[model samples]
Target chain A: MIDKQVRTVAEALEGLQDGAAIMISGFGEAGVPAELIDGVVAQGACDLTIISNNAGTGDVGIAALIGAGRVRKVICSYPRMVGSRHFEERYRAGELELELVPQGNLAARIQAAGSGLGAIFTPTGYGTKLAEGKETREIDGRQYVLEYPIQADVALVKAYKADRWGNLVYRKAARNFGPIMAMAGKTTIVQVEDIDPLGTLDPETVVTPGIFVDRIVRIADAGKAAA
Target chain B: MSAADTIQRLDKQQLARRVARDIPEGAYVNLGIGLPTQVANYLDTAGDYFLHSENGILGMGPAPDEDHIDWDLINAGKQPVTLLNGGCFFHHGDSFSMMRGGHIDICVMGAYQVSTRGDLANWHTGDPDAIPAVGGAMDLAIGAKQVFVMMNLLTKTGESKLVEHCTYPLTGLGCVSRIYSELGVIDLGPDGAKVVEMVDNLTLEHLREMTGVDLTMAQ
Candidate 1:
């Protein structure tokens, strides 16, 4: 049986070590794998490097992880939000490091890693401070900055549903970053609301194929908890 | 009458409506957070305009009522929004591709400063105490086909935001195509800033003095 289903968040988070580069899939609060992140906190892995679109808001998910002093650095497009006091405090106190990339570049870099590309030339961030140290080239009369791939040791994803074989589908705008993070992570662990039986999910609608996902754990009440 | 007393400036809603009127029909638009988001309310609902939120929604609708709010379905600003009919969602990679790939027609954004050459400065003020968060500003600045900026012509201290050159960090070089401000609408090109229209009682000479940049009447 090719079952990727795990019984608990702890089982899904196994082998996550200190200093691991983990991608937390989300855009702000939506699509964030809060249960998995809470599991990571309980698992006691420190010095983690987190990659996401936003640092986190309020005292939950990434913000809680950062507040716990478990993260050493964050590589994201936007690390500041209304309730992101935890990240701000650590950054100002010199406890956490930040690598800010343009939003498009951030998505492209992760996609490049997943797609197994060497590098990409993008118009975003060209002729700006974000591209200050990056290489530049003119392509067909347009300037582009060279951006490299961003890989991760682990990816924590939240999905609406998944099959036993790990085929995943997401809901609405909450789908952001889940598919690409699934591909880029060496070990992608997903927290889903429901795990359907094998062959129940139509292959045509599968957003993240089972090949990219390593572990699946169903947090049955996650949808209600997040609400 | 004093110069201040004689001048007329558009309120935020009026400026938003003014900017909204210029959006072409059937265009795909991205409204940046803050002042630019207000333009959505002023857009012609009868027109076939698709609102793109960088958070992976297309055909995005206005803010949902409190009873229908869903936390998962939100805009880039993290505000609750409704998805219109034919709306769809995708992952971040595809969402940004639509922006950076030149598929979006227009993007309205708020800016701190704009130069005569259409240079944009809004992401960072270089304040040591301020936490710099670029978000998708740089991408939207350079990605959209037509970058329309909405801002006040002058700061509260009376400093001109339309300047000879931007003193703050540049978001993108010469990416802004037009600007809609409280004082008037202006277009930028190789010839420099051209005044499209001004509020009632606002003279070109006075507007020039207020902007601190050379302005020509649009042909």
Candidate 2:
């Protein structure tokens, strides 16, 4: 049988090692794979480079991984929020590194990595200090800065549902970066709420095809856990 | 000091209305956090306008009542908001593509300081102790068709925010075109910052003296 389903979070994150670049999909707490993140924490992978939208909030989820001294750097758009004191304190103290990419550029760069593109010219950071060291070109009088792809060794994504074939469906706006991350990562692990039988998921509704997915771990009592 | 000096300047709501007046009809706009977000509430009702929130929301409506609040449906600033009739949600990547692809007509943003030459310095205050959060300000600054800064003319410490040169790290250069402040509204052009309007209570001299930048009164 061709099953992408993994028995536990450990099996889903088997090859994640030290110094690996991990892309986590989320917009705040919306699409984060908590069980996969917890597996990373339990595995104690160090010197990790985390890529996401915002730095994890509070001492849970991403913050817990950072708090445990696992993450050495973070590449994100917004790294500071209400419960992001862990990142703030460490960053201010020079204990952690942060690369702040604009939201658009961040997404485009990740997409470029997945699509086998080298670099993209974006007008987002043109004529700014962020563009200072970057190569820029004027296209018909408008300037565009070159941004390179942001690839990852592993991607941890959360999906609303998945099939035995690993076709994924996302819930509402929580879908955020899950699809893109799945594409950009060398190994993609998905934590899903429900696993439908093979051929049950509609082809049009499948946000992420099983081809991109390496493992699917179903969190027990997903309804209660998500609540 | 005259009693006129005691009169309060434009509050958050008044300043928002002033900024809203300049937005043309049939436009797609993105409003930044804080003061800029307020501008949406005062937009002209007749226009077929669409609001884009970077957190996967497009065609955003006014803030929802407390009873109807949905935490899942929130704006870029993470505040609960209602979706308009035509509103739809998409992935974050698509939301940003709309922002950075020049689809947005205007972006009204809150700034710490804006230079006479339209240089913006809002993401960071240059304070070492402050936690830096760049967010989507950089993309909005350079990608929108026109960038409008909505902020207080002076900082809380009585320092002018409209300066000849910005001291803080810039979000973008030569991006800002118009400025809406409590003291007055100004247009940033090749010549410099020109005072387009002033509160009736304040004089040109008072504005000049406070700003320290040469302010040409619009004819």
Candidate 3:
């Protein structure tokens, strides 16, 4: 039952199928799961419905998936890369279906979904074109805003070190969407630098629980030093 | 203490009034993307009321004058924004962790239905026709210590928007503490809904007549 055989991030991501709603964590390259992205690209998984904070600068993070022509739809907030604007151009050209979300809304929607909330409301885009075709209600006598859930089928996350049982801790920006999306998905696969035995991690720092995670792949420093 | 002077019909000037009084010195606030954004327009803050945008901007100031609206510096809504003198850029994730972690002191947001029980249902009405986008309201409602709602008193159909229970999708259950309306200020506290003040010339009965829910006067 124990598979201690470690692999590259790309080797681990090599088996995904089509039409998977994958949630990848990271604000940018800071904590982008290099192996996870490489794996997804190596596998050539297509028709991917990606849910993340951003698509990252092209040639990095989830943008690599976009570059591989593996992503079918992107449910992200911002997709602009610094200088290389072609990925967005490809999206606008209908090569990729882009579903933009307000950054906060995107995070909350993911949290709401993970929490089993039927729905949540806010006035983020009230009285604008964004509020079009939305249900308007009167409460106490004032108008409020509304939105729905954002669930994922597969969540790709990176952690600094994870107990084999899947307790995760992220360093800084790499922690962005991991813990939340870890709870918000059906199958959460974590790629980490070190995999430890149970009871090794401090309870307070273990931000994610073992129950939310399904798979883990360790990226050894020696094996990934050149990468 | 005077009802007529304490609360006014939150017109442009009245909203301007609340914005001036409610925001204290050296506060960090996020003007919730829409009507709550108007708060920035009425600040008497001679120096700072650091604004946080979930889109990763901190130390945000007010909307710039018509001529200075910068394209690169935008708020969460993708609308152009201006930063205060000491503002700087950082990771968006840190901005959100600050939001969800309760580092934020106050948040001024718009509401659809704030229950007498203080439940907030502002995201979606859950109607078949309306498509709601449940955003960070849940995070802000639960994350902020004191949640202040700014809203109009009626729907376009003349129905009250505040209610006993939120019928639409909820942003957060029982998160609202106070509401600043076109009519007056209502506090949703432990005892029930208490009217701290009324819009000038607007009587309790008149307020009741305009609302679908029962109105209990403040002690």
| Native A-B contact fraction in model 1 | 0.86
- Cα RMSD, each candidate: 1.4, 2.5, 10.8
Q: Order the candidate numbers by DockQ, best to worst.
A: 1, 2, 3
Q: Tell me the spans in candidate 1 whose CA falls farther than 4 Å from its real position.
A: A222-227
lDDT of each: 0.91, 0.87, 0.70
- TM-score per prediction, in order, is 0.98, 0.92, 0.56
Candidate 2 error regions (>4 Å): A220-227, B2-8, B44-48, B65-69
Would you list the clashing residue pairs of candidate 2? none
Between candidates 2 and 3, the DockQ winner? 2
Candidate 3 residues A1-227, lDDT tens each? 54422455554554578988888876545455667777877777788898876675657557667777788888875565453354666665679777767566677778888889988675444443345687766667645557898998878887778886777876533455677788887878888878777777888878788788877888754533221
Q: Tens digit of lDDT per residue, candidate 1, span B50-116?
A: 9999989999999888778898999988999998998889888988999888999999998989998
DockQ of 2: 0.53
The alpha-carbon deviation from the true structure for residue B7 of candidate 2, after best TM-score superposition, in angstroms, is 6.3
Measured by DockQ, the strongest candidate is 1
TM-score of 1: 0.98
